[model samples]
Structures are given as structure tokens and as C-alpha cells.
Target: MQITNEHNEKMAKMTFSSVYPHYVAKVESKGRTKEELHQVIAWLTGFDDQKVKELIDEKATFDTFFKKAELNPNAELITGVICGYRIEEIDNPLTRKVRYLDKLVDELAKGRKMEKILRKA
Candidate 1:
């Protein structure tokens, strides 16, 4: 897919729920943690939902998604999104669990709103 600035905006706004499954499968099958998966996606596809899905659906055996980023330049922007954060900052368990639950919903009914699941309770 194309990697325009508008595309980057859309990716940055993508709720974790919409993109979590690809990472979940990778994490489970490859022994990578949540952060590791995100980092890989960030490095490879720049956070475009469609490209990330394509990469995951390919079942690449690499630890991170950097193996074939050239196939999707959109993933390059995803790397910028993750430039300085530590893995713990993004691997929020509570938020991740909520995303997993959202995954159960049908695509037509799924909420794309990015709620602050990591609230300071």
C-alpha cells in the first residue's frame, strides 16, 4: 500500500484492537512478547493496518516484522511512531486484553474508536 502522510495519520489513529490479532498470533507462535511484536510491526510497516495484516497473514518466521518492510513502505512510518518508547510503555496488558475481547466482535460491528484502556485508576 501507499505510504502518504494521510496514511500515516490513519495508522497512528488505528485502535490497538483492530491491529492486535496479527501481533497476537505472532507473539503466541514465535515466543515474542507483545512489545517485541509491536516493535517488529513498527519497524516493518509503519503501522498501516492492511500491510501489517498482510505481513502477519504471510506467517513469516522471523522474530520481528523487519524482514520484508520493503514490500510495504507504509510500515516505515510505523517505525517513527515507536521511536523512543520502551516496550513496557506500549505492551500494556490491560489495554491489550481489552483489544483481545474486541477481536471477538464481527468486523461490521467492531468499534474502531481508540479508548484509553490504560486509564490511571
Candidate 2:
């Protein structure tokens, strides 16, 4: 599907809480822990465990979720394809943030080491 403005809008409006469970399930199924998943999330968006839980409890949309985030400076280093789109090539900033999280979760589920998944200088 073409990632038009409407598609970006739809993605931005997607509830982070609705997708959080699936992320937990995915990682756990692959023998990864929820703590590991949270670590990845913290590395990307700087949301602590408590804040994440609050967001989940409130069912915050991606828009609200990211707006509250102090995105990591290393986030732009998260490059690669996820969900068939090259994350670095994604023009919409919010959509890219969402995909960056997806990519981190994917890497965690795939057994990538934390050091590699959490990019650094």
C-alpha cells in the first residue's frame, strides 16, 4: 500500500496501547522478556516502565505517545526496512518513529544483542 498522507494519518492515530500487547506477545514467543522489550522502548523513546504502563492504561494514540516522548538522539541511526518500508526513507516523522519502535521490537524478537539494537556513536 502506498504510504500517503492519509496512510500516515492512520498510522499516527493508531493506539500504542492496542499494539503494546502484540509486541509483548511477539517477544515472549521468541524467548525474549518483557523487560528486554521495555529496554528497547526506553532506548528509542525514553519512556520509563511506569510511563509506558500509564500510556497503556490510557490507550494513548501514537500521536499522543510520541508527543510525550523525548526521542533518542540515536533514533535516526535506526535504519532498515520494516513492514516493507525503509524506515530511513519514510518521509513522515511520526510514521518513522512508530516504525523505529517496530524495528527495535523485531530485532529483539529476532535475538539481536541489545548493544547492536540500541545504536550508538
Candidate 3:
């Protein structure tokens, strides 16, 4: 569920009102700061801080996150797309499930890969 540079570019062009919540969701779910989210947008879409802030202030939605996160066809990559520290790997079924869900939430927060995370399931 890798997001291509092209997809990231497309996301950057979306309206702020239409994309803000997604930004909020992504950052909040992953327990990341606005700065961290900014880094992710810069890494994945090449957007600067100003642009990332605009989106954060807009009316973001689940759809917006879905588009920005690029969930489809790149789910696998989401789990590995380092945020702050490395995503911890869980092997216990209960812990694994919880960790898996947390990781998925983290990825989706930024419109990330879902398949790689799913593979672990």
C-alpha cells in the first residue's frame, strides 16, 4: 500500500476545508505532534510547513485522510513507514492484535499503507 509520489502530490492539492480533519486524525491517532505530521507530508508529498498547516486547519474528513494516507494498494508499507521511533513489533496474539490496530491507526492517521500491516494479521 505504498503511496507514490504522484498520489502524495494529488493529496497536497486538495482543499484545506476538505483535508484538515484527516490531518488532525492522522497526527492525533499516532500521538504525533503537528511537527511530526509536517515531516510526514514533506517526506511523502513534498509539501512545506505552511501547506501542511493549512490542511490541519481545514475541515478534514475520513475521506480526506483516506486520500491523503493512500490506504489502498500500499497497506503493507504503512506499518513500516517510520513515524518518530520505530514501530514496535508484537508477537502475542492479544498484544499483536492491539499493536496491529495501533499501527494501522497510526498509518491511517497519515493516509498510509494498510496491506503490509494486514499481512501481519
Candidate 4:
């Protein structure tokens, strides 16, 4: 699927806290804890618990949230389909990164092992 600038802009403008409840619900409904959600996000974005809370409290946009992140070195290892788009095939760097987080949360909801989800060595 072709990812357009308009879609990217829309996603960029979305507030992290606004979307966070859905993410929490997605995993918590499947018996996952909020801390696990935080772990996966931290692994993907290199944000500590406090920093993640700060972003949520500030109601940061996806652009602001990711801009302040130190993305993990293994982020490139995240690959596969998310919302019908293949992670490895996404051409827009920012969209790909956003989708990577989406995919990670999807996997967490699907009960993927924490070590694998975090792309641990």
C-alpha cells in the first residue's frame, strides 16, 4: 500500500496520550500488564518509564514523541505486516517508525514473548 503524506501528517498530529488508552486496552484485554506495554514502547523508543509518563502528561504528538526518542539500535529488526503495510517495505521513514510501534503493540496483544518482542539478543 502506498503511504501518502496526508496519512503521515494525520498520524503525526495524533496525540500519544489520546492513542495510549487504545493500546492499553488492546493488551490488557488479552491479560497483559501496562508495564509490559511500557516495556515494549521503551524498547522501541528508548524512553524510560518517567519519560514515557512525561510525554503522556504533556499530550505530545507522534512527531514530538518520536522526535525526543532515542530509537533502539535493533529497531530495523522489526519487520512484517502492520495495518496491511509491510514494515520493511514502507518508504517513508517516519511512517515506518510509527507503524513499527503499532506492530509491536499488536504483537504484544497477540501474546508474543517479551524477549522476542523486544528483539533481545
User: How big is the positional error of residue 38 in model 3, measured in Å on the Cα after superposition?
Assistant: 0.9
Q: What are the models' TM-scores?
A: 0.26, 0.96, 0.33, 0.96
- Write candidate 4's Cα lDDT for 2-97 as tens digits: 888899899889999999999999999999999999999999899988998999999999999999988989999999999999899988777888
What are the clash counts of all predictions, listed in order? 4, 0, 16, 0
Score residue 6 of candidate 2 by CA lDDT. 90
The true-versus-predicted C-alpha distance at residue 115 of model 4, in Å, is 0.8
Residue range 19-107, candidate 2, lDDT tens digits:
99999999999999999999999988899999999999999999999999999998999998999999988989999999999999999
| Candidate whose lDDT is highest | 2
Error of 3 at 110 (Å): 9.8
Ranking of all predicted structures according to lDDT, beginning with the best and ending with the worst? 2, 4, 3, 1
Using TM-score as the yardstick, the better of models 2 and 3 is 2
Name the regions of candidate 1 deviating beyond 4 angstroms.
Answer: 33-121
Give the Å error, residue 3, model 4: 0.8
**Candidate 2 clashes between residue pairs 3 or more apart in a chain or in different chains:** none
TM-score of 4: 0.96
Q: Kindly list the per-residue Cα lDDT of model 3 for residues 24-97, writing each as its tens digit.
A: 67677676565655554454434577755655676553235334542233223444434332334422222222
* Candidate 2 lDDT for residue 33: 99
TM-score for candidate 1: 0.26
